[model samples]
Target: LFQKESHIPLPPKKDYDKVRAAIEDALDKDDYDDGSYGPVLVRLAWHASGSYDKASNTGGSNGATMRFDPERKFGANAGLEVARDLLEPIKKKFDWITYADLWTLAGAVAIEAMGGPTIPWRPGRSDKLENEGCPPDGRLPDGDKGAPHLRDIFYRMGFNDQEIVALSGAHALGRCHADRSGWINPWTNAPTTFSNAYFTELRDNKWTKKKWSGPPQYEDPTGTLMMLPTDMVLIWDKKFKPYVMKYAQDEESFFKDFAAAFSRLLELGVPFDEPGKPAPA
Candidate 1:
């Protein structure tokens, strides 16, 4: 008699650690931008989860829908293919884990591996079958916009101003590739290392609009560092300024707040079971 065998998934923590290691291994590259893909990985995690709308609760990390059409092709998600492709092998290696969990966990792992805070992450996200789960194109923040725009975007996701400021600290990690975002330059000197340097740079730099053919962006005197309108608005806005100053002065506070907010960000719209319910397969 021939009988089919069913597959069993490993314990969440055990497999999560494996996936984390795989992502960490995939991070460093001698030839990649800033010698690591950590930035883009973090961006992937952000875009994956940032689509959540607190009211409708339609789009978020729950489905890992960015893998499909229209959403993957969105301008805001531009260049994220690098991040998705980087994780593809990891997905194959840990086939039992869902894309939603893998993408969010990779973001957390990449942040920690890059010398940032330890963001608490959990499993249970399932992949959406297709693009129907994709969020609308304009959901993500526009780099060219200012303070009000930043609030509208983050507030829609149920994030308060403090959390918005905290999450913005992630700007420390990656550069804007012209081919992708139509903007160029790193936000900090050590783009691969996550730190409060982003805040410090915003506080210290004497920024002037860059004279370039590309979209408007701010630059320091040496022309080495850059800031998008959204990044600059953190300091410009009265409400966001205190948090910015707090993070710039105290790395510990920044790390703590960032970890909490980022962890929350990843968990948005995910419908985890009730406490007593059986764990998700």
Candidate 2:
């Protein structure tokens, strides 16, 4: 007889909800970034899942590979340690839940709490042995590049043009730390909340080149905000522009698509176990 495919099962439904509430409670604090841990948590989930290379099926959130060496040291993952460490206490509390599931659930919870879309996430990812399945680096998108690079990076993960545009809307939440991405800018004034403000601002505002020494980022005439070249491509590329315009004009559409893409992101790899074995335990 042929052997069955291996996979971790999902946790019990109630247990999954409890883990989510715990993550939200731990992050809903006064002392965290943007008055909440929402943004970093989103980044944590993204970095974990974004390593996916669909052709090989080797990288993604399912392995929680960022917890190990080399993968953790990747330039793209530079500041994510803060996010990982912040969740340590919660991990200690719910020791049974895999880091893979924890990080993704945290992302979903953060989105909902920050007034973003309801990201439909399930908890079934199991942590791999240390150094067992860390993917090759350079999988994440570069902040300085334009449309072609964005397409190269995202399309490798199997995202279509619309999904890529929708995912980029996540820029609405966090600021780029100069120490990390070298482009210091927040996509929106309310970097704490999630909204279609990024698409709207790009559509309505005149983004002038900021006289900055670091890199060629665009600043609005208001002189209070900025956009990276990567952000600009959303409007410049004919393929991506339609989605940006659609999102800018319709927040409902952005929310719906973003939620679908995000859920898909967290489940990039791993075979689900029979019955409910993949649910959070």
**lDDT tens digits, residue span 96-202, model 2:** 88899899889999999999888877767888998486998899988788899999999999999999999999988888888877777688999989999999988
| RMSD each, Å | 2.8, 6.0
Q: Relative to the unseen true structure, what is the C-alpha lDDT of residue 49 in candidate 2, on a scale of 0 to 100?
A: 96
Candidate 1: residue pairs that collide: none
- Scored by lDDT, the top model is 1
Q: List the residue pairs that clash in candidate 2.
A: 9-277, 9-278, 9-279, 10-277, 10-278, 10-279, 10-280, 11-279, 11-280
lDDT, model 2, position 18:
77
Model 2: residues >4 Å from true position, as ranges? 1-14, 274-281
**RMSD in angstroms, candidate 2?**
6.0
